[model samples]
Target: MLLKRAIGVAAGAAVVTAILVAPASGAGQADLDSAVREAMLAERGAAASADFGTPVLAEPLVEPTRSNDQGWAFGTTTIPAPDVEHAGPHTAIFVAHRQAQGWQVELDGTAEFVEAVERAPADVVSEGEKQLFARNYENSRVAVADTGLGLPWAEGVAWWMGGGPHGDSGQSRPFSSLDFNGGNGQVLSAGAGRVYKSCLRNGSGLVRVVHENGFSTTYYHMTGLTDLGDGQPVAYGDYLGRIDVGLPCGGSTTGPHVHFSLLRGDSHTKVDGQTIGGWTFREGAQAYGGYAERNGTQVGTGGRITNHGQGTSTPTGVVESGQNTSVNVRSEPRLSAPVVDELPDGSVVRIKCTARGDFVDGVWGRTDLWNQRDVGGWISDGFLYTGSDGPIAPAC
Candidate 1:
């Protein structure tokens, strides 16, 4: 799975989701019709956009349209020490509407939302007057690979060093840094930014470079440490060094390795890396990519988008909501049950439903028309916003 494999390369990110409705029982078919009607009644006209984050459950997430109603998977673990890895248990999730105040969680027949929160501490994130911040956060994380195995981690893609394949796929390591095992390299941005990081490690020798995206790539334990350093800048396929850092890290990792990590600071602490001291950059991707300890903890990672399907309209006949509709209606106040279907512009499709509603995408809202049978595989919010002044920017 994308998420499973992504765990092997810690340089990337993850996502999560939430349930806003309460279910009658743990094992019962969700009332899609009722939910749709409620959403339709509650969601109408125009509305402003609001920010969101990972959600905590207040109750069981019932689903009649989706295959499974509740389930969760393990995500990446932070390596606290050389041999210690921390992990959370399998989680259950769902989208719910209306429940008794505060937040609630349903584990089997257990009812304990407030108790869970009291046991665990969290950071505060508010979106003005909107009390829906928690819901957005939970919803956003749902689409991410971090929550489940089948999610999109941008995971397990081939390692392409350009026109040809690099090494034998995941077998290749970095040229230096040789300090860990079992995909133990850290993906560091020589500095900080909303920058994206790349994976490039070989078990030969010293290999590291900074990219324009505020990310860094380094290979360790190689038979080399390329002369590039200090104010050096490199990309995914660039050669930083050759593998063979003697056999220090461990046996599972032969030769050298690239100790990749995303630095919380702005640049490499040491430049030359010539055993004694190295060069350093004052600013830019170079300074950030340079070697250095993380100055702080990761505030947060990737996020999912909310107020999705905003500003679009589509007709919703008796078809299932969230499903694809033949007629593309960009509507606001996204309603469930009448799953919407949308075809690329110019595609031929018969009218399905003419439901009038508004969608909230960030700060924009569009009308919507959901198809009865085609909403599951519908285009992502990414493809939905093809044109328009602001385009479709999700509130992830």
Candidate 2:
């Protein structure tokens, strides 16, 4: 099944775009991801057209979700960043299994709109391609010195499960020592990239490499090491530094382990320091190239086909849609009240309530229906098909 690939992001939105800044060292995890997402959206939007519609929430929505097996929650709505949508904000989402391809996809708001999440490249290493695989086991502990089974590089699900920590239980016995055949703190490249950042006074707290493909992989918590000039390019598996399990020099870690991460394009997707292996530990970004030509016109809390006649919403700030969709509204946007009945996607929601800002949740923009204000919550801006009627397109 091959479809025409469309351009990403809006046409010529590069004006309000922000710059990408790599953290020196000790950069906060949240800050890192935010920078990456914004840059990607800007790029994607440049090529974006009206073909794909982004789901906009009246408010933000946060819920627990499964990214790989990490079981981390995320904000469902994903808006395109100002400058790029073609590059897209680095995000992860659970694709519905109904698609038959067995490939995961970006689950934006409506399930009906998805075609495919991730399509494998022509030469992608499929299952039958490799006969037998040897797990790169340094000491039999998953996250310590583990590499892809009999492979040098890894991506997607295989990397999420293999690269991070694993045990019998969440509190299983730790590995006493991995294979003595290699260095402990010896950091290898998570992927090919240049040294965007080095061990500095205050940064991601380790050496950060920016790959050619805009991905950034970090080698965190180093104890002993020599200095390499920042921005120096290196191959995969290059020596970064050594780590002592007992030290907390750079970003504090429980034991000696290199904190690895993958930042798609924009080069600075932050890794929240809690350290959940495999899954990128960030939300999957879902952005469209342009406004989903809405014919039915999603009615806001004003009940009429208007922004209360105050002109259409002219948001000045960035609206994040991926895992940290703090800008979405979950309840109905009919009136200044909460929704009483539980409605799924595609349900005709009457604007029973409309409260400016947020009510229950802390989303920046929230709205409620008038009739059902009790169980009714924020209508989440990132839903497919605004207002009440239309040609029924897929949500991004």
Which candidate leads the pack in TM-score? 2
Candidate 2 structure quality by residue, lDDT tens digits, 187-276: 445444444332133222345554433233444445454355543456655666654332222112334444444333322233322112
Q: What's the CA error at residue 339 for candidate 1, in Å? A: 10
In order, the Cα lDDT scores of the candidates are 0.22, 0.28
- Candidate 2 wrongly placed segments (more than 4 Å): 1-183, 202-204, 245-251, 267-396
| Alpha-carbon TM-score of each model against the true structure | 0.19, 0.25
> What's the true lDDT of residue 216 in model 2?
39
For residue 10, model 1's alpha carbon misses the true position, in angstroms, by: 44
